[model samples]
Target chain A: MSTVTLHKVCKTFGEGKLAVHALRDIDLEVGNGDFVCLSGPSGSGKTTLLNMIGGLDRPTSGEITVANQRVDQMDKGELAEIRLRNIGFVFQAYNLIPVLSARENVEFVMQLQGIPPEIRHQKSKEILAEVGLNGMEDRKPAELSGGQQQRVAVARALVSEPALILADEPTANLDSVTAEKLVELLRHLNDEHGITFVISTHDKMVMGHARRLLKMHDGKIIDDIQQR
Target chain B: MGIVFHLAWRNLWRNRRRTWLTAGAIAFSTILLVLWVPIQFGAYEIMINASLAVFPGHAQIQRPGYQEKPKIRNAIDNAETLAKKLRASNQFVGVATRAQGFALLSSGTRSYGAQVVGVEPVFESGTSSIPGLVKKGRYLSGIDAQEMVIGAALARNLKIKIGDEVTLIGGGKDGSVAAAILPVVGIFESGSNELDRFFSEIPLHTFQNIFSMGHSAHAIAIVGKTVEEQDSLLTALRQETKDRNDIVILGWEQLVPGLKEGIQVDKVSGFIFYGILIAVVVFSILNTFLMSVLERTREFGLMLALGSRPKRIAMLMMLESTLLTLMGLIIGMTIGSALVYWVHIVGFAYPGMEDLAQQYNMPGLSRLYPQLDLFNFLIGPGSIFIATNIVAWIPVLRIRKLEPVEAMRTI
Candidate 1:
């Protein structure tokens, strides 16, 4: 079964003569456990497409199905539920809540899901360790390095064990070594846990690690390539 | 929920100076209100007690229509028996029967019209502060003594002194001439110009015989231990006289309507000042929370994208304000209560207040003891708490309108 499907999705910002079409006629599908990468230059609608798939933005026209639920038709509350229960997000900025410690950041989603504290603690610890962030559980985002903060974000995303992960330029702020390590971590999680990933990136390292690559130009996908 | 609380608490301290400044404003306002409210109330209490003490005790029982139009014929029949019943109850500190009439008094050429109240000396001594306030000679000696205690102003106006004779002439209850030639045995200075200039007291038996009001008096004045006890005492008085339609029970507010109205007007002005104070603090709270919200736009967007609801975000912001308000209230009330308690023990008086009070016939306000009751203690801090949360909602409402995509782009 497919983890996500988009048919004729289009997104526009503003209105009238000033309108900017951010996405146009996007059609795609990612099967369960597939590792897919969306690569493009600036203004290529890669992030907008990722936002659409994650239920963060609504398409001006078209249908988006995530985990078999029609995302485009859901209300804001339903969209939040869909994001909470079925999808995880990793942002380009390593958007860990600045006030929360690393472990608390990892446990935020579980807490929102009303998971018990003991179990949440246990799961957060294991996930932080998997992301190679052990012994750094109590450091706030400000106290951590860029790569460490990114790992905490990764741990936060993967700890909830959602069916799909939408990453928007996850390696944008990392050095080559750290970016390679992050891509490897994402690949490991996708391969070991059978979690599907749809990553939007300009990094060759991240794109090379994906099993399939989709390239986009202005606001439309120009090529779909299978690497492995 | 616990995580949200933790997050909110940490967020509040992100700008330590701003948080402290906001909380300090709240604390300062709380302290001002906490201190001012009880003082105002204490002043009101003093005013009520002082006015009541001058003549109209905490309450009174008079014949129907006597309060509005007190005529010599509008007397409560067997008033002493009712006073005896009221005095028998432990609810009252003092109860005394009195007959009052408008009489023309003359002392060899100087003449003035005054209200003459005839009272039982011993009972009047217990019920009225006038007995203790007599500046010369003494209060009346007997229930039938041909003696009078006139006010200092009246004594001055009539050019009479103790041991001098004054003639009183008035219309009797039976339409005959009520006339008396009495010696002034005491002179009292009540401080009130009206009472001092136009009021005098004589023995009840003399008043009854001269006015032809046998077994009757104008009012039965009742004094309770404290002004707060007036309501319950008035209720009991009403219940005691429920079977009699000829008499009506009245509390101090009814007996002296102007005093109550004065207090009401003063309270409204006090509330207006307090409203301005609280509104200033509320705007400070609004500014603080709005800045916090604006600064954390990206963080909120990230949280919303991670599956937290807008309601949850709003609650988190509200929790921050609640925590801040709670901190301010705790500190403010603690310090405020301690200060008020100290003042209550030592008493508070403004400079030159005694002279000012004496000038206005309100000697009670000279030294005020602010009582920090539960209502006074909570009212100020409670208003701040409620207002802080209410004003906080203005900024928090912005969270509901935040689109994760748009908010993330805010910076």
Candidate 2:
């Protein structure tokens, strides 16, 4: 049931004279176990499109469906419910809470969902271990390195087992080697867990690991390539 | 709620110095309130007690117009019987009778008008402070002794001293010229200008013999455990002495008009002072919380984005404010109570108060004890706690308007 369908999505930033169109007319679909990368230059609507899919922002005029629920027409609280139950977001710079440790950060989403503590602990441990953070559960974000914190962020997104993980430039801060390792881990997670992933990034390394690539410029999608 | 508590408690210490300073403000207010209320009440109590100790006991029983007209004809003939009747009730602790009259006293070349009191020496100890306040000489010896204790101001005016012969001249009960020569035995200073200048005490039998009164008393002073019992004691006296048309009873409040009004003024001012203290502490707590919430805009947005209910975050802030205020309250009350207890044990006094009181002809201050009460202890902290939460809600409600998406964009 991990699915997303968008119909003629359009998003604008401001009203008439000073309006900045962040996303243009766009139609797209993603199925279960799809590793899709939205690759684009700066101000190219990739982040905006991902925000729409995750219900973090509303589109100006469009219809959006993720996990069989309408993301565009929902109210703020309803949108938050869908985002809480079905979608997980890994932001570019603000993914992990700075005050919480690795394990606490990973357990954040499960705690919000009213998950039992014992199960949340079990799932967070397993996910952190799966992301190569086996011995770093107690280290806070301030203590952890960029790559380790990003791993904790990824663990958080995957621990809830949401139908869709919307990550916006998750590897933009990590070095090339760490970034490659992260993309490879995401690929492995997609292969093994069958959760759909839609990542927006300008990093070529991220695009290289995707099975489908959608390139955008000036708020419009220019290329949609299914390589595999 | 547990997680919320954990986060809220930890958040308080994120700025430890600031948190403590805010709490310190509240603590300072609390300590002042706890200490000030008791001391104020104690001061009023000391004022009333000292003033009443000199002459007017807490309540008095006298013939109908003895205080207005101090003549031998206004004497109560059955004062002892009425005192015995009143003492058998549960209300009266001590009852002492006196025969008082006004006369001119002369010693060689000096003379002045004096108010003479004839009292039972042993029974006077329970009702008047004159027995305890005898300065240079001793009080009157017994019911049969021809001895007199005069006020210091009167002795100074007449140039009289211990064992000096002072002659009293006045009219007796039968309209004859009353005259007597008595040796001054003691001198008492009651610390009031008028009382020290015009009062004297002599043996009841000698005074009655000089005034030609046959076993008649002028006034009776009643003593009880506390002033709070005076009203009930008066009511009991009313019911007991209803048949005696010639006698009357009056409490000190009825005798002293301004004392109760002064106490009421102190109470009102105490409450207003405490209200200002609470307001200052509440504003300090609110200002601290508002700045804290404002500084965490991005962090709060992230929390909302992570699926925390807006109301829950507000409740968490409220919990933090409450905890902070309670911490201050505990510190303040502990220290305040300790200080109060220590002062109660050792007593509190000001330097040179005795001399100052004597110089001004006013009652001098001694060691004062405070009243420890429960309402100030509990309700004072309770009001501050509620006030802190109310002010803390102002900023958290503003935080509720934040959009997670916009918040994420904030640096």
Candidate 3:
């Protein structure tokens, strides 16, 4: 069974002479528990494709299916619900809510899912510990380092146990060692938890960890390579 | 929802100085409203009571057309008997019968035209301030004393001193000459130029005898214990005289001429001032929340992308505003109530207020005591809470229109 399927997906930005085609006729499928990497240069539409699959942005044309639900046809509220129930997003900026502490940031999605407090607390604690952030659960995002904040973001994304995690340059701001550690953590989660991941990155180390890689240039996918 | 509240509260303190400043503005406005509303109302109460004490007690009963025209012919027959019954009811503090006629008084060729009121001396002292305000000599001694208490201004105009005999001449109720030679027993200064210059009082029986009014008087002035009792007293008075169509009951508002209109004008002006104050505070709230929302655009986009609905984001902002307003209201009400209560107990007087009150002929109005009932206490803070929430919606509504893709790019 496929966790994500994209058919002839096209995204255009702006209009008239100023229009930029950010994604063009993209057809791809990721099997359940597949670890996929999308690799490209700056304007190669890697982030846009991730956005389309996560239901964060709508395509100018074509259909996108994630976890067997049509993503392109859903309303904003429905899209939000689909993301809540099936997809977890990790942004490059390590977008942890600044007001929330590390544990609370991880528990935020569960709270929105109406999980009970005892369970949410226990789960959040376990996830933060797994991310090696034990004893730092009470520290706010500003109190954490770059690598720690990114780990917190990853903890938040994984805590809800969604079927697919879409990471957009998740390690771009981290040093090579931290970035390698984060990729290792993602690989461990993918291997042990059977959680599918489609990561958009320019890092060779991150691309090397993926079971499959898709290379793109000028909004068009140029090559698909299966490595493991 | 509790998490949302928690989040909202935490967000409010992200910029602690800004939050405190905004809440402090709200608190200041609340304090102003809480104190000013009661004080203004207190002043109005003092003004009413002082004005009523000068003559028109809380209410009056007059022969139907007498309030408008006040001709001697339009007099209430058996007015003394009616006043005695009203006084017996124990509903009023004082009830006095009075007869009034326009008369010309002369002392050695110096003359003045004054409305000569005939009052029952014993009851008049309880019901009217004039008897207590005698600056010279004494108030009239009996119901038929043939003695007069004239205003000081009238005495100066007529060149008559106490113990001097003055001749009053007027057309009688029976179409005959109403003439009298009476001694000026007292000179009272009422502080009002109109009352002091044009008003004089003789005994009610003396007035009836001289005017050929035969057991008839113009009005029965009734004084209640407090101004708040006026309405129920008026209702009871109306019921008491319901069958007697020859008379009308008038409350102080009606009896005092422009007093009601004056209070209404003052109230509207007060509301305008308060409105300006509320507008200023509401704009401050708007500015604070708008800035908060604008600065948190990326954070909101992150939340949206994390599967939080737009309404939840809006609710978070509203909860922040609600919490801020509640904090301000509690602090303001606490401080304001203490201050108002202290002033209410000890009383408040402005500089030169006594002299000013006397100058305006409202002498008892020198000291104002604020009345802080539930209405006055909550009105100010309640308005702020509601206005803050309403103003906050301006920024909060923008969250509903936010697209995660667009909002995430705001930074």
lDDT score for candidate 2 against the true structure: 0.83
The TM-score measured for candidate 2 stands at: 0.82
Scored against the true structure, residue B262 in model 3 reaches a CA lDDT of 94
What is candidate 2's CA lDDT for residue B308? 67
TM, every model: 0.94, 0.82, 0.97
Kindly report the docking quality category of candidate 1: high
Please write out the lDDT profile of model 3 over residues B267-307, one tens digit for every residue.
99998998899999999989999999999999999999999
Clashes of each: 0, 0, 0
* Residue B192 local lDDT, model 2: 68
Give the RMSD in angstroms, all C-alphas superposed, for model 3.
1.7
- Each model's lDDT comes to 0.91, 0.83, 0.91
> How far out, in Å, is residue B102 in model 1?
0.9
Interface RMSD of 1: 0.5
Cα lDDT tens digits, model 1, B1-411, are 778889989998999999899889888888888888998999899988888877899898888798999889999889888888877876778888999999999999989999999899999866778887788999999999999999999999999888999999999999999999999999988878889999999999999999999999999999888899877888888887777899888889899999999999999999999999999999999999999999999989998999999999998999999999888777788788888898898889889988866654455667998866889878888889998899999999999999998899987
> Which scores greater on lDDT, model 2 or model 3?
3
Candidate 1 C-alpha lDDT tens digits along A1-228: 999999999999999999999999999989999999999999999999999999999999999999999999999999999999999999999999988999999989999998999999999999999999889999999999999999898888888889999999999999999999989999999999999999999998888999999999988999999999
Give me the runs in candidate 3 sitting further than 4 Å from their true place: B238-245, B354-364
Tell me which residue pairs clash in candidate 1: none
